[model samples]
Target: MATLRQTITNALLMTAVVSMATPVTAQDCATPGQWLTPGNQHAEAQPPMGWDRLARQRVVLLGEQHDQAAHHRWQLSTITALHSRQADMAIGLEMLPRKVQPALDQWVAGELDESQLLDRTQWYRYWGRDAERYLPILRFARDHRLPLIALNVTPEQRRELSDPASHQWTLDQRHGVPVPLAASARYRQRLMESFEQHSSEQLSSHISEAFIRAQLVWDSSMAAALANASHQHSLVVAILGLGHVQYADGVPHQLTRYGISDVTGLMPMAAADACLAPTGVADALFIAEPDAPSADTPRLGINVERTPQPLGPDRLVITAISPDSPAQYAGLEEGDQVVAIAGHEVRDTAQVRALMARSLPGSLIPVEVLRAGERRQQLVTLPSPSP
Candidate 1:
C-alpha cells in the first residue's frame, strides 16, 4: 500500500501547477510589467501598467493579512478599478465558508442586512477572528451588485481534513483534484517556524504532517471553488491571507490541477510573513503602508452586545468570551456591563470601539465591568497575532 505522503506526492506531480505557457519561473514572474503598487499607497495614485496586464488575466488574486484594515482597503480599490475597466468579475472570500454561500447571495442581493447576514453565517463563532475589517468590502460588493463567492471549508470539513483517521482521500480525489501536494522546502520551513511560534510543544514529524495537511485543505478548497466559479471567462478577484496567495504553491498551484492555467498572484509588500525567496511571495507585489491602528481598536477581545436603551455610547454588555481570548482570561462573563476599558469610560459600543482603536493587542488593559451590580476590575492580556 502506498504511504499517505507518497500518495500526496504522486497526486501533486501529476498536476504540476499549470498547463499554461509554462510554470512561471522565479525570474519570469516579477517582470517590470507585473509589479503593482502597495495597498495604502495605491489609494490616491493610479495603478501601474502592470495592473493592466493582471486585469486582463483570467484570475487575479489579492493577498492580505486578515486583521490589517488597509489590505481590505486596497482590495476594494483594486476591485473597483477593475470594474471601472468593465471587467466581468466576482470576488472570492476566505472568511466565509462555502456553507454560507446563501448568506453571501442574500447579502449581495440586498435581501439581508449586515447584522442578519453575519448572524446567518455564524460569523462570530466560525469567523470571529474579526469581521469589522472586511465589512467595508462586503458593503462594497452589495452596493455594486458584484458577485461574492464564499471560498472556504466548513468547520466540519476542516475537522475531517485535519484528522488523519478520517477518510478524505476519496472525496479529495473525487473531482480528480488532490488537496495534498508536495510542500516546497521553503514552505515546509516556514510552516515549522509558524508552528513553533504558537506551540510550546516539540514539532514532531507526525504533528507537522497534520498541520501541513490542514493548510493544504484550505489552499485546495479555495482554488477549486474559484475554478468552478470562473466559468464563462469571468475574472475572479480572490481576497485571502497572504500565506495562501503568497507562493504559487498555494491556491494558484491548486488551480492548475484542474487545468485552468491563467492566474496572477499579488501580495501586499508590507506583509510580515512575506516569502523573501525571490519567487515565493507572489507573481508580483502590491505596495502599501501599514495604517497606524487606533487606541480604541477594541483589543479587549470580547464579543459584545449593546445594552438595550443604553445610557451612553459605551453601554455595551458582554455576550461571549472568545476561547483563548484575552477577555476569556480576564474572567469576563456574559451580561457584564462594560463600564470602562483601559481606564477609559465607555458608555456604549462606539466609545468602546474608540477606546480599543487606541489600544494594541497584547497590551495590558485595565477593565472595569458592572457584574451583578458590583463593580469589578480585571486586567486583560491582548493576544495579537505576530505580523
Candidate 2:
C-alpha cells in the first residue's frame, strides 16, 4: 500500500502533466476575453474566459485559495457576470453553517444588510479576516434577491464524525437524509487515514481529528444544500475552497453520485500560468492570471536566533490556548505573554511552537509567563501521544 506522503506526491505529479485535451466548444466560455478586464489591478487581468459556458450548466463550482485576495475578487466578478447572464441561485458556501443560515437567507431576501448578515461570531469563526473577500458575493446575492444557501457543518457534529469508531453510527443517523453515499464513505476513509498518519502522542489528537471531522461535515452540508437548491433553481453556483471544489471526489463528484450530473467547475489560474483544466465531473474549466505585486514585501515573523529576545512589554502574546492542551493544563491563558520556555527566552508564536514540537511527550517544560502584568512560572508536562 502506498503511504499517504507517497499518495500526495503521486497526485501532485499527475496534476502537473495531465493536459486538458478536450477543446472548449465555441458556446463554452473558457476564453479569458469574456470576463476579465484589461489592466484591471484589483481584479485578475486574464480571468478564466470560458466560465459563461460553465455557468450555463446545471451547477458551477468555483474553487478558490482562501487567502488569495485576487482569487476572491475574481470569484465576485464571476458571480456578477453569471448573474448578468440570468443565473438564478447560489448555494454551498464553505464558511456559513446552518446556525447562521437564517442570516444568509435574510440577506438574500433583502431583510438584512451584508454587514449585519455575516456579523455574528458563528458565521465568522472559521473565516477570520478572509471573510472580507466574500463581501462582493454577499452584496450580489442580496442585490439580486438570489437564494444564498449556508453549507457548513456545525462544530459539534464535526467532532462526532471525525472519529472512525463513530462513522457507522453517524451514517445510520444521517441515512435517508439526502446524504450522498459515495461522498460519505470517501470522507470517512480519507479522514481515518489522515488521523492515523499525522497523529502522534505529542500533539492533541482531538484537535487534528476535529479539523478533519469539520471537513466531512462541510462536505455533507454542501451536498444537502446543493440538492435542495437544484430543485428550486436551474443554474446554481457554489463558492468554496479550491480543495472542496477540485477533484472528482469533491462536492461536484458527490453531486454526480447523487444523480445530479450536469455541472461545471471553474478555478482561477495562477497569474504565472494559463490554460484551464477539467476537474473530475466538471465538463468545463477556466483559468485566469491576476496582476503581479508592485513591489516585494518582506515576510513578517521571527528570525532564528540561538538567543531569544529579551522579555519586555513587547513579549510574545498568547492569542489562544487549546482546552486540555499542555498550555491549558499548565494554566496558560489567552493574553498571557511568554517570558521564557525551558529556561530559554522565547520571542514569538513560531518559537513557542518550535519549542513545543522539540519537547518529548511527558517531559516537563518550565514556562515563565506574564499574566495581567504579574510574572509567574509553571511546569507543564506534555500529554501522551493522541491516537
Candidate 3:
C-alpha cells in the first residue's frame, strides 16, 4: 500500500483550479475514487481520496507556506472533516512562542477577542496584509476549545542552531545544548553529512552552528511534548514553515529518534510541487492557493526627488536615514534627492536598503545627492547594523 505521503503527492500533482466559466460540480470533488482513480499509474492520477482513513491517523503535521491563504483554507477543511468524526485534536502553531502559551490558551477559551489574541505587529508578520485568510483559523481553534501549542524555537536558540563550530566544542559553550546522544553507528554517516553541509565560515560559522543545534533541540522538545500528550487525543497537528519540516534531518526525523515511529507529515502542495513527493519525513501533502494574493507592496524608509523635476521615477527621494548613520555623517539630509548609490540609479528604497544592509562597517559607499537643485557626491563610511 502507498504511504499517506505518497497519496498526498499524487493528489497535488493532479490538482486543477476551479473555474467560474466551467464550475466544478460536487461530483468532481466528492472524493478521490468517485472522480479520480486510486493508485492510477497513468499520466493523469486522481484527486484526494481516502479521507475517512486519513482522518484516523494518530498525528498529522500540516506543513504550510506562511503567506498562502489557500493552504490555510484546505487545512481548515481537513481539520473540520476530522473533527466531525469526533477525533480529539490539538493544533500546534509556529507563529506564537511558548512564553505566550497562557495568552493563547486564554484566547482559545473565548477569554479574548481577535485583537487581544493577535496584536498588530504579530498579525502583520504572520498574515501580512491579508487578514481574511488567517482570521478564520483563529476563529475555528477558538470555537473548538482546542489547545494551541507554540512550537517555534526561541530567537536565542535559533541563533545557536545556525552555528557549526560549537557542535565540535564543549557542551557548556553551546547556548542551548541539544539532548545528549551516545554515538549511534547507524546514524554516523548521516551525521557526518550534516556536519559537512553546515560548516561554519569566518563571519557566519558560529551563527550557522547555533541554528542547526537549535533545530535539534527544538525537534526533540516538540516530539517530547507530542508523545507526552493524552492517548485519548486522537490526533495532534503541527503547523510550521516548510523549511523546518521538509528534510529527513528535520523535526519528523527527530520525532522518529524519540521513539514516535507512527507519525505523518503533510505540506501544502501548491506552495512547491516538489514538496508533495515522499522524499523525507513528510508523509502526506496537499497543495492549494490562497483566496487571493496581497496587493500591499512593502515600503522603504528613503524617498528621492530629482533636481529640476517635481516628481519622476528617476527623481530619487530620501525619506529618512538612520540617526548618526553614515549617510547622516556624510551630510545626507531628509528630502535631499539621491542621484545615485555608488553611481547606480536610485530607483527606489528597496535598492537603497539592500545596498546598506550588505555593507560592512567602515566600507565607503558613494552617495550622489540633489540638494537645493545642486548635485554633489559624498563618500560615506557605513556603520555596523545593531544585532
Which candidate gets the maximum TM-score versus the true structure?
1
Q: Is candidate 1 or candidate 2 better by lDDT?
A: 1
The whole-model lDDT of each prediction reads: 0.66, 0.56, 0.52
The deviation in Å at residue 351 for candidate 3 is: 22
Ranking by TM-score: 1, 2, 3
* Model 2 misplaced stretches (Cα beyond 4 Å): 1-53, 164-214, 271-285, 290-387
lDDT of 3 by residue, 1-387 (tens): 124223322222222211001332222222221212211212122224355655676666666665566677767876777777655788776555455677777888888876556542243332223445556877888898877776554544544543555457564454324453332342333333334433332324443333334445555555545654525477777766554454434556666645766566655553223222323434444535334543233222344433346454356577677765566778888988787776655444444544454456556778888788899888776654344
Q: What stretches of model 1 exceed 4 Å from their correct place?
A: 1-49, 165-169, 172-178, 271-280, 296-387
Q: lDDT value for candidate 1? A: 0.66
lDDT of 2 at 380: 80
Across 237-333, the per-residue lDDT of candidate 2 in tens digits comes to: 8887665654546677567655787766666553223332332323323344444543221111222222333653346676666665667677777
**Clashing residue pairs in candidate 2, if any?**
29-50, 30-50, 31-49, 31-50, 32-49, 201-385, 201-386, 269-288
Find the candidate with the highest lDDT and give its number: 1
- State, as a TM-score between 0 and 1, how close model 3 is to the true structure: 0.54
